[model samples]
Structures are given as C-alpha cells and as structure tokens.
Target: MYAVLSVTDKTGIVEFGAGLRKLGASLVATSGTAGLLRDAGMDAAVIGDLSGVPEMMGGRVRAFHPSVFGGLLYRRGNASDEAEAHQHGIPRIDVLACNFKDLVADDGIAGALDSIDIGGPAMLRAAAKNFPSVLPVVDPADYGEVLRALGAAGGEVAAVDPAFRRSLAAKAFGRTCAYDRSIQRILDTTGDRE
Candidate 1:
C-alpha cells in the first residue's frame, strides 16, 4: 500500500507511519512530514520528488500535481482505469493521513492568511471520494482503528468494509466543509451566510 501523510497536527504521526510500514506499506510525505519520518528512520517518498514538480511560491504548491491526484482519483480493479494508471505512472494511493493548517493563529496578519489550506483539503476530498480503495484519515485519533483494520486484513484495503469507508468519506467531506465555512466566516464582514 502507498500512503500519503501531510498534516499540521503531528501527534502520533511517526508511530502511525511506523505501524503502516510494519503492515508492508510505504509513505509519501510532504516536506515537513518527510523530515519527521526520516528522523524516525522510516523511508518516505517526497511529494515534490514524486510529482516531478519543484516546490514553488515558498512551498505553497505541494501535492497538487497529476502524479498525486491521479493516484487518489483513479479507480482500482477496473481494467481500463488500472491500465491508464499504469500508463500514467500513478502509484496506487491506499491511504491519506492529513490535517489542515490551523485556521486561527496568534502571530498576526501573516498567520491569518496562511491558515487557509488549499492542498491538504484537496487531497482529503479526493481520497475520500475513492474510499475502500483509499482510506482518508483526517484526524489522528482514527489512526489506531485504521491500523487495526489493516493489520487484521494483513494490509489489504479490499478487506475493509464499504460502509466503514463511506462513513470515513463523509467525515472527510464534513471536515473540509467546516474548514471552508470557518474561512468564509473570517472573510465575511456582514456575518451573514450570503
């Protein structure tokens, strides 16, 4: 399994990645997460390197490339999709462990704008959309449940139930929606939904 880990909340990430490695999974990580994984002695493929795109705009453009999205969006088990994935060199993304940047920060103006996340939510939504095939974990707390399920299946995503995957997808979508709403609220001066 190929897992992607990009998170703002770093709690339990190293151990979670280690557990994934134990289950015969490799990690694809963003710059910060890759540094942490390397510190823990785990091998990880950097997102920029995998995408063949240089990190630009002071590291703002990360994981938005086709190499990343194709892995998350492609359908598995479909002969055409599988053949296309192979032709495009998109590795199968089995898991997406992610969290967004904090929406509220006390450091001032720079922090406020930087809090809005673009890439993280996109990855989450895509992975969630392709559930059962891809487990999108937004909260670190659910990592244990996912690890247990994967361990029980000996690391095969197909062994996990469709309903559970659907539930997780719902959670991923809800989280992104809430995050966007918060951003809207901060941007809104009138305080009305419209």
Candidate 2:
C-alpha cells in the first residue's frame, strides 16, 4: 500500500508516518515532510521521486503531477483506467494525509498570499473524490483513528468501512471549502484597501 503525506502542519506526522510504515505502507511525502520522516528514522520516498521533477518554483510545484493524481484518482475496477495506470506506471495511493496552509490565520496580505496552498488542496480533493479507493485524511486528529482502523484490518486498506471513508471524504471537502473561503475573503478585503 502507498500513502502520500504532504502536510504543512507537522504536529503528529512523524509518529503517524512511522505507524503507517510499520503497517507496511510505503510513504511518499513532500520534500520537507520526507526529510522529517527520515530524521525520525523512517524512510520516505520524496514526491519529486514519483513526479520525476525536483521541487522547483519555490517548492510550490511539488505534487502537481500526473503520477500523484493518477495514483489517487485511478479507478480500481475499470479496465481502461487500469490499463492507463499501468501504462503510466502509476501506483495506487491508498492513503492521503494532508493539511493545507491556513490562509485565514495569516497576519497580513503577504502572509495570506504566501499561505495560499494549491497542490495540497488539489491532492486532498482528488483523494476525497476517490474515497472509495483511497483514504483521505485532512486533519492531524484523524491520524490515530485511521491507524486503528488499518490495524484492525491487518493493514488491508480495503478493509476500512465505506462509511468511514465517506466521512473522511466529507471532512476533506469541508477543509478545502473553508480554505478556499479564507482565500476569497482575504482577496476581497485586500482589494477593498487597494
């Protein structure tokens, strides 16, 4: 199983990543996140490794690749999807653990603009949209519960309940919606002062 983790807020990420690794999940993470996981003594593949592009454009271009999205969004049962995925060498991303930078909490226009996360939200939404095949985890608090669920099923990703996956998808959508609203509000207020 493959788990993609690209969280800006690294509250309990190391422990969670370690737990996932112990459960036989290969971890693919953003550059900083991968470094942290490695420092914690857990090996994690960098997102760039999957994307075939080094993190460039001020590290903003990470995870905006077909390999990442294809892995998250590939349909399990569809023959064409399976063939395309195999053709592109896309591995299935069974789990996504991500959190966006908080635009609402930024102190100023510069901070807000800087906090506008693009790739993170896109990946989260893709995982959520494909929730039946991928587990979407937006909040750090959900880490323990997900680990427990996976553990209960002996690390089988498909063993997670459909209802639970739906709930996680809802949460992922909620977070992305709130994040977009925050960005809109900031832009609106910024324009008013201009």
Candidate 3:
C-alpha cells in the first residue's frame, strides 16, 4: 500500500513510518517528514520525487500538485478515474496519515495558530473527500487500529471501511472547525470590537 505521512506534529511519526515500512508499505512524505523518517532509518521517498517539484516558499508549495491530488482523490475501482490517473502517472494513495500543526500561544503570540498549514489542510480535505477510495487518518492514536487492520488484511489495508471512513470524515470536519475557531478567537482578541 502507498502510505503518505505528512504531519506537522512529529509525535510518534518516525516509529509509525518505520512500522508501516516494516509491514511492507511504501512511505511518502514531505521535507521535514522525510528527514525524520530517514533519521529513523526508515526508507521514505520525498513528495518532491513523486510530484517532481521542489518545496518552495519555506515548504509551502509541497504536495499541491496534480500527481498528489490525483492519487488521493481518484477512485480505484472506477475505470474512468483509474484510467485518468494512469494517464497522468499518479500512483494510488492508500493511506494518508496527517496531523494539523498544534497551535500554542506564547508571549502574546500564538505559535501553533501561526503554524496553521495550508497545503496540509488541502491534502487532508482532499483525502477525506475521497474517503471511499482513500483512508484518511488524522490522529496518531488511530495508528494501532490501522496497523491491526493492515496485518489482518495481510498487509493491504488500502480500502477504507465504511465505519472507519465515517470516523475519518468526522475527524476531518472537526479539525477544520477547530481551525476556524482558533482564527475567530484570534480575530476577536486582535480586532477593536465590543
């Protein structure tokens, strides 16, 4: 299975990627994530290699390519979608493991709020939108469940189960809601309004 591991939170990610690799899955990641995986001795291919585009603007322009989106959004069983993906050289993305940047307030500035990722959110939303074809995982806590499912399925947990897909959709929506709330709170505090 092709597993994409792009996370702002580096918690347990190296171990998770290593475990996934050990379970016979290909690991794909962005710059920092790829570095972490390599540092942990896990074989991870950089997203740029797949997308053929280097990270630009302080790692802002990574994973925004058609290749990445096609992989995450295309339905495997649909002949048209699969054909289109093949024509565009897009590999199927089975699992998307991601976590939003943790916003932390410090010295009258919110570090985590500032670190809100644009590309990460877009990718997560795309994966969640195509949940029938893609398995989107936002919480590291769900790693064990995923691993268990993969093991049970003989190292092929690419298909998103109905129940798990619903859970992932809920989590994705909650994450967006939380991000909006943070922005609202920041605006409320900074703006001059009653």
Candidate 4:
C-alpha cells in the first residue's frame, strides 16, 4: 500500500514514515517531509515525482495534481476507477498522514502561516472523503494505532474497520476546520477581516 506523508508539524514524522516503510508501505512526501525522512536515512520519494508538479510559491503548491487526487479519491471497487488509475499510472494511496501548520503565536508563525498549504488541505479532504478506501491520519498520536492495525491486518485494515475509518474522517474535517479558523484569526488580527 502507498502512504502519503505531507505534514507541516514535523513531529515524529521520521519515526512514523520509517515504521510505515518497515511495514512495506511506499512513502510519498513533500519537500521538508522528504528531507526529514532522508535525513533520518529513510527512503522517501518526493511528491513532485508522484504528482508531476514542482512545489511553487515557497512550497505552497505541492500535491495539487490530478495524479495526487486520483490516487486519493478513486474508489477501490469501481472498475472505472481502476482503469483510469492504470491508464494514468496513478497508484492507490491507502494511507495519508497529514497535519496542518500550527497557528500558534511564535516567531516563525507569520511566514509559516503564509505557507500553510491549500493543496495539502484539499488532498486531506479528498482522502477523507474516500476514507473507506484510504486511512487518513491527522494526529501524531494515532501513528502507533495505525501501525498496530497495519501489523495485525497485514496492511489490509482499511477495508475492515468502519469505526477507524470514521474516526479518521472526523479528524480530517477537524483539521481543516482548525486550519480555517486559524486563517480567520490571523486575518482578523491583521486587519484583513472581511
């Protein structure tokens, strides 16, 4: 199974990606995430290779391709989805580990907020939308649970656990909602309120 790891948090990501890799899952990550994995001597491919798009605007435009979305959005049981994925060379992304930038009051929060990532949220939402086929993880705390599930089910648990899937979808929506709230707060404080 393929796992997409595009997190701004950068907490426990190296260990999480390594664990996923150890379980025979392929890792697709963005710039900083790829760097973190590589720095920890883990094999991680850049998301651009998977999506065919360079991360532009200081890495804000990553993972915004049809390749990315198709992999995350395609239904596993649909023959047409499988055919289209095969035709476009898009692999199914079974797991997505993503966390948005924390909108906290810090020295780098301003610049980081500027690169808070629209595409990442969209990808998370799409993966969450297709949660029955994909497992979306938003919190670092759930890494071990996912690892345990993957271990127990031989990497095929995405199809068997409706409660787990729903929990992931709920987290995905919460992350997006928090992200939007952060942006709104920033706008309000910066006099960009509308």
Candidate 5:
C-alpha cells in the first residue's frame, strides 16, 4: 500500500504517518514533509524520488507529474489502466493526506499568491475522483478516523467501506473549493483578479 502526504499544515502529521507506517503503508511526501517524517524516525520517500523529477521552481512544481497523478487516477479494475500503470512503473496510491496553505496567513500579496497551492489541490482532486480505490484525507482532525478504518479493514484498502471513502472524497473537494474561493478573494482585494 502507498500513501502520498503533502501539506502546509503540519498538525498531527507525524502521528498519522506513524499509524500508516504501522499499517504497512509506504510513505511518499514532498521534501520538507519527508524530512519531518524522517526526523520522527519514519521512512518516507521524497516525491521527487518517486516521480523521477527533482523539485524545481522554488518547489512549486514538485507533485505536478504524471507519475504521481497516474497512480491516483487510474481505474482499479480496468485492464488497460493497469497495464499502462505497470508499463510506467507507477505504484497504486491507496491513500492521500493533503492540506493546502491558509490564505489567512500574515504574508504580503506576493507571499499570499505563492501560498495559493497548486500541487496539493491537483493531487487531492485526482485521488478524490478515484475514491472507489483511493482514500482522500483533507483534514488532520480526521486522521484518527482514517487510521481506525484502515485498522478495522486489516490495512486492506479494498476492504474499506466505499461510503467512508466517498465521504472523504466529498470533503476533499469541499476543501479545494474553499481554498480557491479564498484565493479569488485575495486576488480581488489586491485588484488583480484574474
């Protein structure tokens, strides 16, 4: 099993990652996130390492690769998707724990614009879109619930309740939508609405 985790909010992440590790899931994360996990004595693969693409553009272009999205978007039971995934060596991403930067941060206009997360929302949406196979976790508060569900299913993602996954997916979409709205508001106030 694989879990991709990237977040601007670091609350409860180490514990959540630990739970996932205990459940036999391999952890993949952005460089900063991976460093924190490693400091916590947990093994985590850097996103660049998994995607075969180094973090570039001051880390803005880290997780926007096909390798990462392919893992999250591919249909589980579709033979063509499976074959293409195998051909590309993209592992199945069974879980995604992601949260974006808060636009409310006391950063200036340039900083606030930078805080408009791209990769986080993209990955979250792709995982949520494939909720039948992927578990999308948007909030840290729900980490324990997800861990419990995975534990109850014996760490078998396929055995997890579809309703639960669907609910998480819905939450993921809601989060992204709110994030975009915040960005739009910021841009509007700055007189640079696009």
Candidate 6:
C-alpha cells in the first residue's frame, strides 16, 4: 500500500511515482529525491520525516532505522509482527525503489567516497528478502514493469507471481554484489596508495 524510494537515478522516477500515486500509493523518499518527486507533481515525504531521524553524517545515514526496516521486514501474516508494527507505528512498505550512485571514472577519491551508498543496498536487500510483501526495484529500466504490474493489480503487488518476485530479488542481490565490489576496489586502491 506504500512505497519508499531512495534513488540516484532520476530518470523516469517522476513518471513512476506519478503512476503509483494514481494507484493510491503513498511515497517516502530521501530529501533530494522527494524534492524531485514534488517538482514532478507527485507528493513524496522525506524518509527522515517518516522515521523522525534527520539525515546525519552528511546525509550518509538516514534509511537504516527501525521504522524503515520494520515496515519492509515485517511478516505479512504474522499477528505478532502486526501487533509489534502497530505498536511502533511502522507502516508496511509494499515497494522499495533505489538505484545507487555510480562511481564515475573521472570522480576522484572524494566523489567516489560520496558515491558509495550505505543505506541503498540495505534497503534493497531487505525489500528483496521480504518479497510478495515488499518489491525491491534497483534499476530504472524496471520502472515501467513495476508501474504496469501495479496498474494491473490495482496497486497490490501481491498479485505478482512469486517467481517474478524471486527474479527481482535475484537482480537486487546481483546489484548489491556489484556495488560492494566497487567499494572494495576503492578501498584496495586507496590502501595501495597509502
């Protein structure tokens, strides 16, 4: 019924968010992404606003809170989980959209360090781990497919096949692996120079 978005790729996000809005889904996004959604005429709340934790460490730490993970990780049919979620005011996040910042060749150490996303991979993994309850989208290319699925199901991604959800999860893992490898390369290179 709700979704979270924290993406570096703005391509097609506006259209995707707008499509979701039409399906009556609320959006939670990082500050920068939220502003872009609003500019595109889709109302999106900042992720910090939902968790009541402002971005700290120069916007590097914001999405790892209980509220965010609880929403994505809660078991759909578990009464205990439901009770705990309600007690903590953790709303269910049916979808999570994120595309990590790409470390460009021209970007020096400063830029590469900043480009390494801490919360994004965590979010993607969580949502993928809880698929059927949460759909994790890590590529801009998948926007249309998601929107179409939402539209077909009248906003309920539960209608999607479990196989498809697994595929999505697999893709998310692949992306996270590549991202972590990139960060590792950076650390190795830095250490070499040191």
Best candidate (score: TM-score): 5
- TM-scores vs. true structure, each candidate: 0.91, 0.93, 0.87, 0.89, 0.94, 0.92
The segments of candidate 1 whose C-alpha lies over 4 angstroms from its true place after superposition are 105-111, 190-194
Steric clash pairs (candidate 4): none
130-194: candidate 2 lDDT, tens digit per residue: 98889999999999999999899788767788899899999999999998998888887775332
RMSD of each: 3.0, 1.7, 2.9, 2.7, 1.9, 1.8
* Model 5 C-alpha lDDT per residue in residues 70-167, reported as the tens digit of each score: 99999998999999999989889889999986586356568787767899999999999999888999999999999999999998777898889889
lDDT of 3 by residue, 97-161 (tens): 88775343442335433466777778888888887767778888888787776667666544435
lDDT for position 152 in model 6: 79
State how far residue 4 of model 6 sits from its true place (Å).
0.8
Ranking of all candidate structures by their lDDT, best first: 5, 2, 1, 6, 4, 3
Error of 6 at 93 (Å): 0.4
Q: What lDDT does the true structure give each of the candidates?
A: 0.86, 0.89, 0.78, 0.83, 0.90, 0.85
Query: Which residue pairs overlap in candidate 2's backbone?
Result: none
Where's the lowest-lDDT run of ten residues in candidate 2?
100-109
Runs with alpha carbons beyond 4 Å of true place in candidate 4:
104-113, 192-194
Cand. 6 Cα-lDDT: 0.85
Write down the lDDT that model 5 would get.
Answer: 0.90
1-194, model 4: which lDDT tens digit per residue?
Answer: 78999888888888899888988998999878988899899888888888778878777677878888999999997999999999999888988998877464333446546655688789889999998888889999999888887777788746447888888899999989888888776655654322
- Model 2, residue 185: what's the lDDT? 83
